[model samples]
Target: MQGGTTIVLPEHRGHRLGLALKVAHHQALLARFPDVEWIATATADVNAHMNAVNDRLGIRVVERCIELTRPVGRAS
Candidate 1:
């Protein structure tokens, strides 16, 4: 499972480039690796745009991960 990164230039957003790129990338990778059974990618939960695209592609939420952050000078 590898390679499904989609990035749209800021100036090129609003044209569905991200969705198109992801679908195309997935198709190409699958074609080149027919033996693969699972492919994985991660995105922040709040990113509705990408999440929606992922959902449309039959990807599902299998796990939830939380990242904790603190300022350098702040005590935990």
Candidate 2:
């Protein structure tokens, strides 16, 4: 359900391995928790590669969010 800092191994490239892993994990979760109503995930807006995978997996983007940051001495 997440991919923060983990690096994919070189041999796994082009196999859609990430997508396969995510689908399998989600299926397992659903099987274990039948009451669950939703599955959610995110990728950076600029990551066309992941977006393509999401599309193939039928994940609809319901909404988007942005992060804001400020320096320690700066006022919001």
Candidate 3:
């Protein structure tokens, strides 16, 4: 299963809510799907807190993806 964006309000930071949320979701996923063996999630490289949460949950980085964008214009 792949996780989507998870956020805790700025006023609610530093309470380990992110970690708790991930843990709860993982437990629920396993409970609902005993045959499932893997879960995937991604966070921006700058997001240290989320990275820490994933690390604590034993989620290792297996791949890296980079996004690139360019403005479109009339062809010359």
Candidate 4:
């Protein structure tokens, strides 16, 4: 099982709803599947807030993907 997504309405954003959702999700997953060793999650580079929350939840970056974009006709 995985965290589908967490989207808090603008008015609800600052209340740590995303963090709460994720932590609760982790707890529920562990309860239902205690033998599971890892739960995978991801966030974009610009999303510092969610990253902070994930860090608080003991999630670490085991790997990262960097996306590079350039004009179709441009090259080094």
Highest lDDT model number: 3
Candidate 1 residues lying further than 4 Å off, grouped into runs, are 69-76
Least accurate 10 contiguous residues by lDDT in model 3: 67-76
lDDT of 3 by residue, 28-70 (tens): 8899899997888888888999999989999999999998877
Better of 1 and 4 by lDDT: 4
Off by over 4 Å in 3: 71-76
Model 1 quality (TM-score): 0.78
lDDT of 1 by residue, 1-76 (tens): 5554577888998787888898888788889988878877899999988898889888998989999888676654
**Which pairs of residues have clashing backbones in candidate 2?**
none
In the range 1-76, model 4's lDDT, one tens digit per residue, is 6467777787889788988988888889989999999878888978988898988989899989988887665553
Instruction: Give TM-scores for every candidate, taking all chains together and pairing residue i with residue i.
Output: 0.78, 0.72, 0.84, 0.78
Tens digit of lDDT per residue, candidate 2, span 1-76? Answer: 3434323477876788867776777788788888988777877899876788788888898999997887675553
Task: State residue 51's C-alpha deviation in candidate 1, in Å.
Answer: 0.7
* Candidate 2 off by > 4 Å: 1-7, 71-76
Each prediction's RMSD to truth:
2.8, 3.7, 2.8, 3.9
Scored by Cα lDDT, where does model 4 land?
Answer: 0.84
RMSD of 2: 3.7
